[model samples]
Target: MLYIVSALKPEAQAFVDHYKLKKSKLNNFTIFSNYNIRLIISGMGVENARLATQTLINNFDITDDDTYLNTGICGASRSYTIGELIECGGVNYNGIDHIFQENRPIISCVSEEVATPSYELADMESYGFYDAVIHNPAIKQFHIIKVVSDHFEPQKVGKEETKSLLFNVIDDINKIINF
Candidate 1:
C-alpha cells in the first residue's frame, strides 16, 4: 500500500484524478483511496499535518509493505524555478533536523513562510508530517516530495498557481512511487 500525504486539495487533485481514486470521508478529512493507494490532505500547517497524518495512520492498518509519502508544493529560494521537483532528504523543525538517505536530497525547513532563506526548500507541513510519522512502528518507507511554487513570496501563491505547480511534478511523483 502507498499513502501520499498532501497539504491542499489542489496538491492532491492530480493524483486523485490520475489514479481514479475514490473519495471517502474520515472525520472532517478527505481521503482519496483506491485498493492499494491512499492520499490524505493535511490542510496546510504544522499542527494539521501532524494530526492528520496520525489520524490516517491510526485509522488504517499500516504495515511494513506500505509507503508513506508527503507530496505538496513549497515556497523555495529564488534560485530554484517554480515547478521544480525536490525530493527532500532532510527536514528541520524548530532547529531540529531529520535526515534521510535518498537521491537528490535537499533540506526542507518546515515552518510558515516569512523571509525565505537559501535553504533548499521551505514549507509549512513537512516537519509536522515527518515528526508524527517517525514515531510510528510501521517499519517501512517514508518520503517527502515537494514542487517549488513561490520564491519565498507568500503573496505570489494562490490556489490556481499551486495546482499548476503540483501538476508539473506529478510525473516525478509517479516515478518515485513506482520505484
Candidate 2:
C-alpha cells in the first residue's frame, strides 16, 4: 500500500475527489483511503508533520514496505522560473553556497551529503518523519515530491487552487508511487 502525506487538507481532498476515497479523522488528522493508497492531510510545519506521520504510522500500522511520500509546494530558486516541477534528489539545509554564472551570483541546490544538512531548498517537513520512521525494514520506498508554488512570493495558494495543480498531475504522482 502507498501512504501519501501532504501538509494541508485541500491537497488531501484533491486526491480524495479524484480517487473517491473514504474520509475519516483521528484526533483531528484527516485521512482518506482508496484501495492500496492512503492519504493524510497533515496540516503544516515540521512538528505538526512529525505528529501526523507518527499518528498515521501508529494508527494505520504502516511499515517499511509501504511507500512513503512527502508531497507539497515550496519556494523555488530565483533563477528557476515559476511553475516548474522539480524533484528533490536530496535536501541540504543551513547555509547554501552561491553558484557563479557569467560573474553573477546565483543560488542553487547545495552540494552536500543528504545525511547531513540543516535547511533544504524545498520541503516544509518529511525530514523529521524520515529521521524518525525510516529505520524500519518494512519501509520499501520513500520519496519527496514538490511543485514550485511561488518564487518566494508572499502569495498563499488557496486550497482549491492547490488541489487543481496537484490533482492534475496524478499520473506523475502515480509514477513516483510505482517507482
Candidate 3:
C-alpha cells in the first residue's frame, strides 16, 4: 500500500483526482483511497500532521512493502522555481536537523507559516509527519516530497495553484511511490 499524508485538501485533490480515489472519513481526518493508494489530509501545522499520521498508522495494518509519503507545497527560495518538485533528504524541526536521505535538500518544518524564506526550503508539516512515522518498525520506506509553491510570499498561492502544482508532479510522485 502507498499511503500519503497531505497538509491540505488542495494538495490531496491532485492524487484523489488522478487515482480516482473515493472519499471517506477516518476519525476527524478526511481520507481518500482506492485499493492500493490511500491519502489522508492532515490539515496544516506540525501537531496536526503528527496526530493524523499517527492515527493512520494505528488504524492500518502496515506491511513491510508499504510506503509512506508526505507530499505538499512548500515555501522555497528564489533559486527554486514555482511548481518545481523537491524530494527532501532531511528536515530541520525546531532547532535540530534530522537526516532521512543523504544529500538532497533539507526542509525546515516550522510551527507556523513562514512569510520569509529564512531557510533554503520551508514547510509546516514535514517534521511532524516524520516524527510520527520514523519510530515504526514496519515502515521501511518513507519519503518527504515537496513542491515549490511560493518564494517567501505564501499569500499569493491560491487553492487552484496549489492543486495545479501537485497535479503537475503526479508522475514524479508515482515514480517515487512506485504505484
Candidate 4:
C-alpha cells in the first residue's frame, strides 16, 4: 500500500483526480483511496499532520512493503522555481534535524506560515508527518515530497495554483514511489 499525507485538499486533489480515488471519512480526516493508495488531508500544521497521520496509522495494518509519503506545497527561496519538485532528504523541526536521505534538500518545518526565506525551504507539516511515521516499525519505505509553490510569498499561492503544481509532478511522485 502507498499511504500519502498531504496538508491540504488542493495538494491532494492532484492524486485524487489522477488515481480516480473515492472520498471517505476516516475518523476526523478526509481520506481519498482506491485499491493501492490511501491519501489523507492533514490540514495545515505540524500538530494536525501528526494527528491525521496517527489516525491513519491506528486504523491500518502496516507491512514492510508499504510506503508512506508526505506530499505538499512549500515556501522556498528564489533559487527554486515555482512548480519545482523537492524530495526532502531531511527535516528540521524546532531546532532538531532528522535525516532521511542524503544529498537532497533539507526542509524546515515551522509552526506557522513563513513569508521570508529564513530557510532554504519551509513548510508547516513535514515534521509532524515525520514525527508520526518515524515511530512505526512495520513500515520501511517513506518519503517527504514537496512542490515549490512560492518564493517565500505564501500569500500568493491559490487553490488552483496548488493543484496545478502538484498535478505537474504526479509522474515524478510515482517514480519516487516505485523506486
Q: Return the TM-score for candidate 1, rounded to 2 decimals.
A: 0.89
- For residue 10, model 4's alpha carbon misses the true position, in angstroms, by 0.5
- TM-score, every prediction: 0.89, 0.76, 0.98, 0.97
* Candidate 4 global CA lDDT score: 0.92
Q: Which residue pairs in candidate 4 have backbone atoms (N, alpha carbon, C) closer than 3 angstroms, thus clashing? A: none
**TM-score between model 3 and native:** 0.98
lDDT of 3 at 146: 97
Q: Tell me which of candidates 2 and 3 scores higher on TM-score.
A: 3
Q: For model 4, how does the per-residue alpha-carbon lDDT over 1-179 read when each residue is reduced to its tens digit?
A: 99999999999999999999999999989999999999999999999999988988899999888899999999999999999999999999989889989998999999888987899999999998999999987778889999999999988999999999999999998898793
Largest lDDT belongs to which candidate?
3
* Model 2: lDDT of residue 145: 68
Q: Candidate 3: which stretches are off by over 4 Å?
A: none
Q: For every model in order, what is the number of clashing pairs?
A: 0, 8, 0, 0
Candidate 1 lDDT over 1-179, as tens digits, reads: 88888989988887887789999988889999999888898988888998888887888897878888888888777778888888888887777777876455655655566565656678889887888789987737888888888777878788778777777677778797674
Off by over 4 Å in 1: 102-106, 115-118
lDDT of 3 by residue, 1-179 (tens): 98899999999999999999999999999999999998999999999999989998999999998999999999999999999999999999888999989989999998887897788999999999999999888889899999999997989999999999999999998897686
lDDT of 2 at 67: 83
Which consecutive 10 residues in model 2 have the weakest lDDT in total? 105-114
